[model samples]
Target: MTSSLRYWKKNNLTYVLHIPPHPIPKSPQASPSKTHVPLRPVSPLQNRTDIVVDHTKWGKILGRIGSESIHIPKVLSKADVHTLTAYIAYLTSSGHPREVKELLWALFPELNTSKYPSNSEEHSHRALGRKGLLTTYRRAIFLGPVFLSAVLNALYKSNQPILADRIWTLAKKAERLSWARKLLPNVKPWIMGPHAYTVMINCYSSLARRQYWRMVLRPQRLNYRTAIASVWGTLRYKCQILPRPLPSHQVMELMHDLMRHAALVVFRRFMNLRHDYAEIPEMRRWLAEKDIPKPDARFFNAALRAFRPRTPPMRKSWYRRQLRDAKFNLDFKGVLPNSNDGWNGSLHEVAKNMIHAGFPLPPGLQPLFVGRLRGFDLPVVHGPDRGPFAYRPQKIHPWLRYRLHTPKEKGLPVSRAYPQFREVLAQRRRHRRSRKRQRNRRAEQDAQRVAPKVLSL
Candidate 1:
């Protein structure tokens, strides 16, 4: 509905009234031409579309920053790197992992470069190349701990432990030990989520093992794990004030896995010193006090395998006892005799090692070692075998089960991808703003029409 107003004044009196018309409904598609921009409405069902759009927007911004040169570190200043950090965090939170990888790739194209030739001339070039790569890594570190932690988590989810450790080293170098110690607890909810913690555990443990091997092979260089351990030792001591039992039970399983791996790494390192049986009991007590997950059979097997000797040491009996205790613990605790995942062969290998070491096999463990039993024994008889097989379907939690899987989201409509149409669209926006003048002129004409009516009245 619309109304027109008219006013008339005579001497000391004035009157005004408006002629009104009945309300009229406007058409839904009335100015379709003006509303031609092809904006896609995000569907709540598939979040990936929204993630892609946001990633694309930030990626374009980063791309523009890198457009000046191939050397991204040289091109982008510290402020720009900080800005990219927020974008990285957002991508991580979205859970659309590919976008994060793509954004990283866009910014760091040098990661894809292959190894250069090995000539002396090329050696100099290679050195320069290494220098350039280090500079870029410095830029990545400038993104700060939060972003680095997110990258570490993503790398772990993608099962790239090697890259995760490299990033961890880069993070340590970029940020001071004191700063990380102070910041880690505060930023943990966002940066040190379960995935990040798991990756950290994996990184520390693997590095510790590598350091032990290096000491065995080349004692000339100081152990690499010692540096990491020193930093962690300080952090752990400072972190005594941290609350126990993390908030999300959803990730408790993963958290336990992390703790178990960390425990094994520490245990393995201690055993590597002199096949120390004392360290095992101490480790158990230490882990218990720390509220870390108790070490499982796999942990014990890993420790045993690490000490498998070419020539038997004086503590051979002690090592055998450790294996026996591990077997006893496996039986006592009723932990899975073998891993559910087909990938794990450590338990079997350790059993064979024990047999070869002149140690008597634990009763009934021989069948498991021989591959007769796969895992937990189930009371099922398949076909006519009537055999108790080691197979059982796991019970999934109600929250973990889902009937609807998220469908993949489609990208932007084809119309927006055309350059000519985009240019036209820009021109249309300009003209749309210019139409304000026409609207003003129309207002002026309406005022003139009302004035003539008022004069006649």
Candidate 2:
């Protein structure tokens, strides 16, 4: 029982047995492990050392070359630097190469000095070439118009007139006329600002041409066809006379000449028309010996107003009467309108007389007369009851009247009705159908409830 109990205790209880004492262990001395052993030194390739030396020599040589190449000698003087800066500024502002040259010459008189001096012409040419060098300077510094003007002035003062003229022309053409004009008087004292003068003359000449064209062609209703044709004809004739490649200075002169020639042509055409009426003895006598009507104050005033150097009140009625009286042919119609005849009959008589007087309808303008005739037949509406016959000769159409008279609120309702009134009416009809169906269903239900039901056996 005791052995069994022990076995049970050993097996079942799993007893923790005690062991006898053992000696304490000492730590081992530190030594290099096989896993952590140091590796042997690697020998570099023999050719690699030579390569490294060659690289070192190459680096030194390249460094020396770079140092030598980058070093620049300061040969320019303090005065030279200032002169160059001023010259560049002048070229940029004035836009003239000649001015640049002159400025350079003024600043650096010794620039032209040589053991053997060149001829005056050669020297001048050389000076111009040097001025052109400023263009390079201009490109570098991005010098603008202010600097260009100063440069041009200098060139002009140096007696380089041709170069100055060329530069001035280019500058004027490149810059806006307004800017050039403002700069002109200031720069003119130093340089020849003739291009500014040319621009002004050309502008005035163009205005004159426009006025003359308007007077001759009489373009009604802002339709510029006649004016365009007249201007084109004038330009064609001017081109034939002067041709192209004309210098800037000569364009104004050419335009003036063309204008004078055009005026003479118009005068001659008027004279030829007057000569046609000389067949009649009285007309011939009048042509031979009649005092030309002297232009009155009104005529001079009209002419001056047409030119319009200043704003003035126009005498529109006087000009209109002049245009009417200028009609040469007249047709006399003697159809006495009866007192009972309407105003329409008088209008018809006047129109017939105009047609008989050889005043044929103008080509594109006939449609306007046709439109007016059609308009006369349209019924005019005054108010709701007093309409369809209350036609004022100049009254507008009924559609236009409705547009002018309709009140904002009464016009249309907000919602789908504003966009499409018909769609709103359709939608209202659909809603009514749905309501009708619902009412019929309710009536049937009420009938069922009221009627008696028989029970089946």
Candidate 3:
């Protein structure tokens, strides 16, 4: 009864306070009747609703660049590209990945045009410095790859490899076009950096990872595992674009880490998280083909770990770190058979490589040809005090650690396609060719309509 009385009181207050306003009195005179003009019928697919983001709103979002209103423009322009690219960089770096993904998707359809407006092509403007020296430059602040790898990275980050690959292809095409046209003889061709190659390598890894994982949880069988895997194998075919950074101590460490990641690819065979098979020799060939780090202790150890059996009661996640590493009380002794036991095929070959890689082993384990496994714990960390090094694999975020499930995160992204998956996956690329084809089809239809109108006239 008390609850019913409270509800009645709330309703009475709403009724008293929220009465609808009456319409205002208007002029009694009727307006003139208007003639109707024929118009193009709108399609359900075409919804052109443009919302202009005011200066204050965008300024706050982009952080103190002064007042600049951002609106949807009809043509693809350099200013739009530069602004959107800058916005993407800010989103990725600021750790607003969701915003980054959204901004990328929204901008792709807007920026996927081949045509730049005439006026927007180049504008020569000068700004005055304190000493009265002039600065002639693009006032809109446009500096990025012609293909927009930033957007490509964004797409990859969102797990859109199919789209990202299209962006990469366009980037190569643009680079060639620049060279063929000799547009800027002075400027060197735009080549992707080390990180970009690594990202592509990682992207292929992810595609394979997805296709593989989906199969396990699947209702049926699928192809495309070999398709994605081959992408990595063929990466170095364009030898010119591949980064060959001088292997300083830092570079060596980077290469070594990448080598282990390659081994990881071997473990899973690029389909899913729990591996399909461990292909050791294929990895060595990949490393050699890329001409990066050679086999090291850590690399071989990773290969051996990849061979760690995924049996019942022991998780695939459990073997993420070195199974032989004493850090988790998982020693290599458990997996090896008695010395009298027979070993065969690729298993024998990988074991030999691991032995040579200075991997530790227990008594009575068969050490493969031309290599010896030491009977002690190898140092957990490799390298000097401050160079590229591996430390204790912390689970606070990574044992594929994702302790927090909220919008605000704790630890690193879980191990999915590649290690440090988030690091490799960056900005976006779009399905530009498909978009362009659709736009052209629409234009052709418009031309057909206009031709009929002209004939009638």
Which one wins on TM-score?
3
Model 2: per-residue lDDT, tens digit, 270-294?
2333343343346223323243222
Candidate 1 per-residue C-alpha lDDT over 36-68 given as tens digits, one digit per residue, 9 for 90 to 100: 223233233322222222234665554344323
Worst 10 residues of 2 by lDDT: 1-10
TM-score for each prediction? 0.28, 0.17, 0.29
Q: Point out where model 1 deviates above 4 Å.
A: 1-87, 115-121, 172-197, 203-457
Candidate 2's C-alpha runs over 4 A off are 1-120, 127-130, 133-168, 172-314, 325-457
Which tens-of-lDDT digit does each residue in 1-457 have in candidate 3? 0110000123323111122233434655744343344333333232121221223554344432222346787987556665777777666666564566565444433223223211222442111121111011111012236326566666667666655665555454454443332444444333333334435545554443331121111222223332233332232222212244232443334333443355454333312211211233353222232333234333333344333332233344443332333222324334442323323443345554444444433111222211223433343223233312233333321221111111212334343456565444542124566678899999999999899899999
- By summed lDDT, the worst window of 10 consecutive residues in model 1 runs over 397-406
What residue runs in model 3 are displaced by over 4 Å at the alpha carbon? Answer: 1-84, 93-149, 172-183, 211-457
Error in Å for residue 377 of model 1: 30
Candidate 3 lDDT at 191 equals 31
Q: State the weakest 10-residue window (summed lDDT) of model 3.
A: 131-140
What TM-score does candidate 2 get on C-alpha atoms? 0.17
C-alpha RMSD of candidate 1: 29.7
lDDT of 1: 0.44
